[model samples]
Target: METTNEFERYQKAKKQVEDIKGFYGHLASYVLVMGLLIFINLRYTPQYLWFVWSMLGWGIGLFFHAMKVFNWFPFFNKEWEEKKIKQYMEEEKKTNKFE
Candidate 1:
């Protein structure tokens, strides 16, 4: 049982590492592609400067991806939500006892 649990944990950790690696890979690709787009836009249509649109759009997505990979928003994280739920339930129990 312990060995199985350990293996499960190891697998979970490995998966998480893979997810982080994938996010970084995505980020690298975004940078490379956006850089190329910017170069093309500047070389071909400097007056219009339309590459900013794609840059901003894809940048927002990459920001969210990075946030998810790094667990940046603590308030919305799963463990924090679970802890808050348990605390609220305990407080409700205490209040009911007093009532």
Candidate 2:
């Protein structure tokens, strides 16, 4: 009972989800790097500037992570992908009609 259009939509959605997951995984690794920096700063210099940099980097990385996890990050949300998919589908529809 599943039409080709339905299957395509499903695949598109699945790929989008995977892309978001990739983003989260990347951000998590970035956070880990920042954690290492924090550790080094604490043991070596104990400077407030290092702490500040850690906080800033963590904030930016966490924001992206949350966006990926929650599927809503201002300009880079599900809606944006949806729009792109829709555009592709529209073009496909036109090509299919011609065929």
Error of 1 at 24 (Å): 1.1
lDDT of 1 by residue, 1-99 (tens): 999999999998998899899999999999899999999999999999999999999999999988988889767777899999999999999999978
Task: Show model 1 residue runs off by greater than 4 Å.
Answer: 84-99
Give Cα distance to truth, residue 77, candidate 1, Å: 2.6
TM accuracy, model 2: 0.55
Best by TM-score: 1
lDDT of 2 by residue, 1-99 (tens): 579889999998898788778877777787688778878888898855476666786788778676666666666666888998999999999999988
lDDT of each: 0.92, 0.78
Q: Which numbered prediction scores highest in lDDT against the true structure?
A: 1
The list of candidate 2 runs beyond 4 A from truth reads 61-65, 73-99
**How far does residue 15 in candidate 2 sit from its true spot (Å)?**
1.8
- lDDT value for candidate 1? 0.92
